[model samples]
Target: MESLRNLPLLDQLKDQSISTLVQTSLIALIGVLLLVKLVQRLRLNLPPGPLPLPIVGNWLQFKEGLNPRNLAELANKYGDVCMLQMGQRKVLVISSPEMAKEVLQTQGVEFGSRARNLVFDMTTGKGSDMVFADYGEHWRKMRRIATIPFFTNKVVQQSRRGWEEEVDLALNDIKEMPGSTTSGVMVNFRLQLMMYNIVYRMMFSRKFSGLHDPLYVKLMTLNLENNRLAQSFKYNYGDYVPSLKPFLKGYLKEVWETNQRRLSFLRDEFLNERKRQTGEKIGVDFFLEAAAKGEISETNVLYLIQNMNVAAIETTLWSSEWGIAELINNPQIQDKIRNELDRVLGKGVPVTEPDIANLPYLQAMVKEILRMHMVIPMLVPHMNLQATKLGKYDIPAGCRVLVNAWGIANNPKYWEKPEVFNPDRFLKEKIEPTGNDFRFIPFGSGRRSCPGSLIALPILGIVLGRIMQRFELLPPPGVDKVDLRSVGGQLSLVLASKPRVVLKPRQI
Candidate 1:
């Protein structure tokens, strides 16, 4: 019996030795293949970049997250158009306004499509949504369908009155908060609720009851989670390095599951409800009508709603917060805007969408906010369909392009005293957010420029203007000024500290 046990143990040792040998052989084969690929890559006359290591090219450089600050430092080292090796992939970081136009506008078509990795592919339903969809006939059709309800001048006109009322309701909510009049209130939470309500009304023809509502809370929670996952540089690292994916399977699975839950909520709660409606018309009726006519698929409709909620809500919420915080910090600027509102619309008069046309200072202030605090600093990444030359640099086909809009805006070469928060700069020179002036492209440009700007501009102006009209904005006690330090690694830049302010209702 002892001999039989010894024989079995010897066989087990032999099996282990064979497994170890096979693993070693496979690794050696892979290393050789990677070396060949590296040699081929070096042979190409690509743009200059730091030396990359095998299998994990330049991945270590962006451990802090590939944010504006990181990209700006790289720009200083390498000229405007610098190449970065993110694993096996090539990325072009365009830091200057001239290069930005060359990629985003001049040759927008060449780099028109978005590059999706494993995560983006699942979240965007294989890039069917307009924002990430490849530049093609399908994308054009989707954009047209979306424009009817979201971007057109008619939609903005129809939604303006509802938006004004929502702002007033939000102001009342803030006023009702305990000690809001004297001790002040944290406006960030309430402000986010208000911004969501504005977009919610536009999308569903109604607003959530308040922040405490169960459905509202659940939706907000899911949206926040989704945004965090989408923007997390650490979470999405596998997208840049394919070899790292086996280790990231669990993380990717969670993200996919979360996105599915978000989509399911939209379908069950919102899309199905719209489909059931007969006598009543809602904001989503246009989409439902198109679905019925087979002009757009049901899946695409659901994703479009998901796109609007995620894309429109948080960015707009933060923009409002930033604008208001800046106003509180610069009380003189706040007073000037209030005096302008009083002059144009009279004291205590609620600002309407059309009133934005007459408020020059308000417009300038908003532009300054956009310039100073770029919401989406690094705009959506673009992909090149073919090898292209950008200013004597040979960019390989399928390389990703990231336009550093924040860097461009803050580059001292373009704007004098770039760090200062002054709206007066715009008063001297005329610039449009239309993305035509590459130096100040907050909304992006070309075929994929943000379509919601027409709606966004008026809504932002109304909310900020009305708040200033009804209240004397002041900073929270003990805090001398608004903290401008941004929390890094978000899809959009967000305030590290949620701004707190006292909204003293004017005695008009």
Candidate 2:
């Protein structure tokens, strides 16, 4: 009886000992993990940022949205080279010109690759296009092919007359509008059409008849929807957090559907028609030839067209709209432009591509507009292909690096009264939009700088010069100035309100 009771006691003691051992082991494992994490953090000199919470990281801070203005506020708090833990993704926001120079130019090769997200992957066909493709041989090939026909000086020479003709047509249409002189007309749609025609003609060798052309309307509507969907931050939670990916099933499906529709439209309407008809080699022909030779895929060609449709057309249109609005807001600036035009290119002659070089003030205005209102404020987020050091902080490979072009351009440290819409600033300093000076990189610098700048700058000058030459743009009656409020997008900043202005025919 004594031995049986002792056996039971011994069994109970054995069970308690095993439980104690298990608890002690668990505690020790947890301690080791915490120590390892602490040591790893101490080893890496990471940039300063707001403390990230568990799992979600700094996502809750961005409940409103991720835009240039919001990023600017962050810069104001955390210095120029600050880190933002956006869920699992590491984002380094560069605000100052010095840091921008380092990331964009000095370390261009290191930071040349693009940061791909779920939405961009779907839209860009998994890096089939140049804009979103990783910086490598494939991107090199696409860039070379795109530059040959669309962005070269020779293309500008060949296409200048056509561009001028389009401008004249636009001007004539505005002049014919009822009450165009007395009451202001909303010319936003007309301008949008003109921009589309310019790019479409270059890409497809075709132009829509007018704003009401069924094809034009369909294409514009699709592009608008595509931009809205692609540029939204709502569907990006899944991108930051892998666990949340299931929630994006419906959203991703919609994006897929929209992309399919867009691709089909491009193929059936434009690419297929081009295939049927043989003509003098045009922009599409260049890509087709490349595809035929196995240089790229047919799908790549379609993605290229998509890029031209969205990137080339929309950004230029936004810049032009902002430029015109500024002119309407400041009449003296208009008079100054008119005087410059008269002095430089004769009284009534329209500005030609070659003439843009001579018109200093007009070029200044273009530069100023680009500086004040950068269409692509963040300049397409860059990625480091390998681990790199940005200033004193260690930037891990695959971190999404953003050069806040808007913040840099508007930073008072670099610019005096950075908020003012003054063209004289450019005249005071020889800051071209060529991205040579880090302070005013309207088009980003280094290897990935916008190839379209060669064509875009001249186009802007000609359009603005031609319009100002023909008509005196004025704000609508009872309005002192056009509303210059802007709404930010994922990649672009656009005028919040469509500007309405009266065009008084100038008798030169």
Candidate 3:
């Protein structure tokens, strides 16, 4: 009997199997409980966020959005600091000025590193552009050298006249536009012409021509249409699912491939231009001029040229469009701005740098538009290099941080009546930072903030101002309210590139 007992009593086979099943079930239940506890414990120290399911965190909340009004809404609910999920990438979004100040200002270095994602790296030839490069000696060199020629006050002065000159051309084109009504049609000519010309002239030393040319078409395609498309793909699998990326099943892969091909072709053209200028007296093109500075490499020069085209053109154009849309929507804003312009420039003169100082209301309008629609909100997902503490929280090494400039700029906590389009918020009064407590500078702050702000704003102010000065902007017949919404899937929040008209020439 003792031997049988030790030997499982000659094996009551069915009963033994039942016992095993019970044990297995109990183990699985305990394991699940332990996993839940473990996960909760691990995430406890992280910032507040919506409850996350395994494998997919808060990704379902905000799709790979160009403009995440959803995220801002979450800030209203979950407090200013929220955590977003993009596959394995962890995004920490700071939606209030307090958090923004902590991340963007007092604790900038802790959150100052740039993202090391595969797509961004591949797009930038592994971040050859100064804007996207990782923080290190090479990045420093890129920032110091490339920024010198491109962003210097001297460069600002040089480009200012060029911007005015090209704007004058756009004005001339608008004036000469043949039409029976005499009022200029509300068209996105700025998309095809002026905005592209400003960046093109600065980069390649001539106005961008050849509408049917692949370069022109590529630049043309890069406008509002592309902004929506790109934003769509960011939240899709091609950007995240490793296995699915190679064998993509959606339009995203095709779109990416086509654009990648265009980028390659454009890069070759840019490089060939540089190669041709190898020993020649390094001409006026920004790429060549920067390469002459010794620290900035030829590859970096090409990168700068490409970025100057893509970066300067896209952001400036889209932002100007928003200012236009805002002006159209808020005629009072436009009327006030136009009154200032009329006072400063009188009639029949295109807006130049001289006219900018006198137009504070216009400046405020631009700032307000930037605040409401932070074109590249989150300001390109800064990274963490060294381990540091953000207030009481311990921000681990290699953590990626996003300063939610969109919410910070528009939070009622930071701005009075965050929803309404009021430029006066930026005018005076010290308010809590949606991040840093400086006057509402939409360009960003610190060493890694956009090196192009000084250039970008004036381009916006001038383009918008001149458009108002030269032509009277009114919504086209049957088009009321200037209702414009973004087409999704871009990484930036630019208006969907539909043509909106302001009655030019005759109507005013």
Candidate 4:
């Protein structure tokens, strides 16, 4: 035993057990080292990020995980562009404006690829999902179909009434209460409005009617705990634990399946409605057009419907929520906006489609809100078809590019006081972001920028205009507006923060 080392490699291994064990152990160690180096190389352009190790990656960097404050703090330390290693993926984060502009605008095609996560695969199959689809024919086709019919300028003109009516209902809902405007209502304004404008219009072409509708009811109620949990679960992965995804693939799958069931229910309803119609093909709604006579498979229809719901639902809703919160916190901005609306529309009159044209201040508020608060902060990752150079880095073909809209939205080079919310900055000179200057990006940019952009503007303008026109949004009794904090799903454009406030109808 004492002279075992001196016996040499061959002699020690002659004891069959030792040789077999030694061979296996050596092979495993080599494999692990090679795998690690491969992963290290995969995390390209290091970009000076915090230390990330094993399965967790840089998720541990923030105790709360990528909150607005955490991002702000990271920028202070690691410049603007930082690569955060999340699980097996290199989450490249840019906290600057110029870099963001380059990624989304000039180098858009090069950087236009989506992160092909397990959730995407499980939900949409082979990256067929529009939001996460590759920047090629399929994505283009799907997007074109959506934009041409539902989101084009003409469609937006058509939707003006829907938008107006929804806002009208909201205004009425607030004022309808005989006893009090802010008493015994107990509703989530953000969630409620999103349903009416986004999900309701996008899917069935109407609003939810009653509590008997389980899916709509379930959707409207905020599951803060589950939403946060689902978010935290996805960001928990790394190269060291490459085979660990299956253990935690519940949320997205469950949601997709739930949506599928809902679509089945919708299909049945549509068929029944068809029976009632005298004699005609399916109506001009998103669903009827996509799967009339079930041309598209039920599964695809389900996926499509579900996708539409989340995208439309969250973007419009979150924008309104944060914008309102911003206004509530900055009463001066609120007062200024109210004055502008009054000057444009006047009191004792419901806002009209023609009236929207004159509301520059309202337009500025929405633009500013989008800039300061990005809906989908980072555009879907843009995939490069061929090799090209961006900045100092010589990017290879097929490398995933993250267009950091978050960084661009708050880039100090383009935006002064980027963090502090201000709408006037948009009014200065010419500030229309036409993919050339990405200083303000709420709905992404380029050919792949959200098709719903046109559809959304009028909807947003109408809702925001009507609400601002009707309500006196006030801070709670003694709470300071300066301390307002925002929170929401990690890595999402959705921001749900600030406690609820009582809204009293003020005379216009």
Candidate 5:
């Protein structure tokens, strides 16, 4: 009878223990919720954005990823400075010129560091090159080295003849193409070759024989693949969501493989060859000397070469391609360019670098194209090294900062009829693309602005001016106008199709 009574007591004890456990769990859960609310209260001053879901955080809304169009849409709703929680990462999109000035110039030091994602990290070798490196002593040294040999006024003066000669060579090749005059010729390859030769000669004292040259084709293929992989929006999700990273193994592998191939080709074919020669200073010679002096590693020198190959060649090519296509689409613009060239340089005289200053219309046209179709819509992203206040909101340290150069340049408040491509707007106004006028920062502004702008501007004028001076760029037979539809990437705005134009030799 005593044992049976003890069993009931034991059962009561077990029930009491179960009740206590449930109470403890409920208390802990409530405490966690309160702590989370407190943390949210602390961050309540963060810029306005759509509420984000746990783990995903605004990612589900971006099916195409965080492209300019989507970001612009968000800016329209959220205001000039909107914060986005992309998974765990915080992105601050600056869409107004005033905010851009604040981020890129006013507190530039606080927001001067480069934002490195997985793809860029791989390509830049963890911020080793000048263009993608963080703002610091190493970056300063690289920038100093790059500016001296390749981007300075002295370098431009010395290389002008070679650049012009490359253009002339390309023109000669176009003339030799079968049915080039009547059936229309695709000058894209020739133009790409000309750009390659111009940069390659400066860097390696070398140039490919033609567009079809095995080495040229290989290099172009590799670089195009590299750019495609690096600039793809597909790779961004993995960077934003750590859990999604395992899915990007194949993509990351391809990027790494492509980078390795590019490095090997550059090292074996160019850098190593330059190492064998001892003579007057070329671009690589400076880098080689820097490596020899223990100022920078040989790996850095190779990356510098990689940067020049992509940055120097690809960007200029896109601009030239866009400029020429725009001229073809607008015959009136072409006539204006031709008339200016003839009046400025005289009939049949080619456009020289120094002559560019006298051609205000040409300069305006360059500005217009850069403004109308910014090659890099979201200029290489910037990051704040420490927590800082931007306008009314608090920006967390290490937040990725993107200035929508496209949105700013195209904002109606800043420019009248911003969508229209009228170079006359630039002619009437004194806005310049040298990052002075924040409304027109195609090459960006501040310490991280493209140093190659000095070279790019002159090249654009020379190439377009010469072509207009020599040939009438017209659309293919029976085609009303070249398709002006552009495909936008995270980093570039390229034409949907390669333009083919009939180059009728002008009787200049």
Candidate 6:
């Protein structure tokens, strides 16, 4: 009986060993199959480009800088559709106008989505804001709600008086400066404030006195910091190789903390002020009313405000600064625009929004400025939801697409004498900035294009017109020419040197 029991136990132990070996063999077979599939997927017909290193691919090429010009240099070497391996992420750089239209227009829907990164997610409240949100139903809903107030011509008409009033205040301030008429004054700082106030008034039906005001200072400081952090290359390591994100854990924590503080201030201070008001709403208040009705959440409303606050101020301000700098550098262009203004609105009379129609030369000059100094050079990167084909090669899913607006605009093939600043190019061509003409898309094209152009254009027109009408802008005494160096590592093409100008009040 004892011998029989030992035989049974020995048989059970042999069965257990056989079962364990079979399971191990099956797992190894499945792993090999999956590895084969991954290799096949990686061997897809990608575009022509440089060979990637072990982990950090093509990143060494950008050791100097990764500005628009630098990216353009890469395009010059590679073809129109060049692929660069940026760590684990693949970047498709569209160079030619034909390729740009294909991505931004023809196959727009296939590549319409926005790429979400760590910094953008934090600044925009995790893709809650309309501008940076991925293309989807939620993006459509937010856009529809946000655009209701600013969609019609009536909106611009209603806001005209406010714009004129602000420009008048800006002009008066320039005149009040002691010896500003003879001795030039730094205009960028003042114009930047005026631009901020105009946007503020349009949003909340109120305005801040100047940058010195506590609230204005706080808001400005926060917004600038957010932009700096969001656009900084140092913070973009994880965007390429996400596996290395653990190294930036501390920095990510700080950004999250800063964003939280910003969101709190936006909700408690700015949004709360709007909520306290009791009246029939207008402007952005229209959207706020919808939020109150539970149509949209308060959190979304705050994010929308944050987007508009930065968008409305920075784009126009930087463009205006560049416009003024260009005019100061080329006095002939200034003379021509003033001549057109004199012919249409006449000197000493306040330039109105509607008056822009009669002033074609002024309009052309604005277009030229936009073409030369693009406000948002890269125009916010786009992404593909699924694998798609552009021309000969196939693009993998989730690839980041950068439309090189600066590259296309300045390409010698597209424009003759592209380096020189000449408004006549626009006068003869008559290309609208509406993105319809792929050759010149300063405001971008397609569904993701900036809707703020309706207000931005008119404000730019009236503000620039009034300034030229009232003041003869000249470079500072010692400065022979206005400096046009660009600010590095920024979303917008900001001027490096804030040009100081002698605002000699024009005689009627």
What is the overall TM-score of model 5 with all chains considered together? 0.92
Error of 3 at 197 (Å): 1.6
Residue runs of model 1 more than 4 Å from their true location after superposition: 1-42
Q: Which candidate would rank higher by lDDT, 2 or 4?
A: 2
In lDDT terms, how accurate is model 6?
0.81
269 Cα displacement, candidate 3 (Å):
3.2
Prediction RMSDs, each to the true structure: 3.9, 4.9, 5.7, 5.3, 4.6, 7.8
The reply for model 3, stretches above 4 Å from the true place, is 1-44, 63-67, 175-186, 210-215, 218-230, 238-260, 274-297, 428-441, 488-490, 497-499, 504-508
CA lDDT, every prediction? 0.83, 0.89, 0.65, 0.61, 0.88, 0.81
Residue lDDT tens for model 3, 1-508: 6786766654677688899999999888767855974575486576666765444445555555424577777777777676655544566776766666677777766676687454455456677777778767777877766566567767777778988888777666655555412433544564447777776666555466534566666655643343445445553555543554655445545455654664665567655655565432322344555567766667676566556665667677778778778777777776777778777777666678766777788777777778777778667778887767766565656766766677666666656788888877656753321224633446677666777776777888888887777666677666677766765333577676554564555344
- Where does candidate 6 stray beyond 4 Å? 1-42
For model 4, how does the per-residue alpha-carbon lDDT over 1-508 read when each residue is reduced to its tens digit?
Answer: 8576678765755788777989999888767856884575676444666767555566565545455456656777887666566544555555666776666667777677665544445545656656767777767656654555566666666656766766676667655544334332323463465455444554455556543466555554423333444355353452214576465556555645644445556456543444355533222344445655544544555455545655666567777777777877877887887788777667756676667778778888888888777766666556666666667554556544555666667767667888888888877845754455566666666766776667566667777777777777665556566234555454475544445555677674
Error of 5 at 363 (Å): 0.7
* lDDT of candidate 6 over 30-131, digit per residue (tens): 667557545744787787777665456676676443567877888888888888877777888888888889998899888888876777887787778888
lDDT of 1 by residue, 104-188 (tens): 8899899898876677788889888888898888888888888887788888888888888888888898989997878788877
Q: List the residue pairs that clash in candidate 4.
A: 87-237, 87-238, 97-411, 111-382, 112-382, 112-383, 113-381, 113-382, 113-383, 375-493
Instruction: List TM-scores for all candidates, in order.
Output: 0.92, 0.92, 0.82, 0.79, 0.92, 0.90
Residue-level lDDT of model 5, residues 97-172, one tens digit each, is: 8889988999888988999899989988999998889899999999988889998999999999999999999988
Per-residue lDDT, model 1, residue 382, is 87
* Clashing residue pairs, backbone N/CA/C < 3 A, model 5: none
Number of the candidate with higher TM-score, 4 or 6: 6
Return the number of clashes found in candidate 2: 0
- True-structure lDDT of candidate 4: 0.61
Clashing residue pairs found in predicted model 2: none
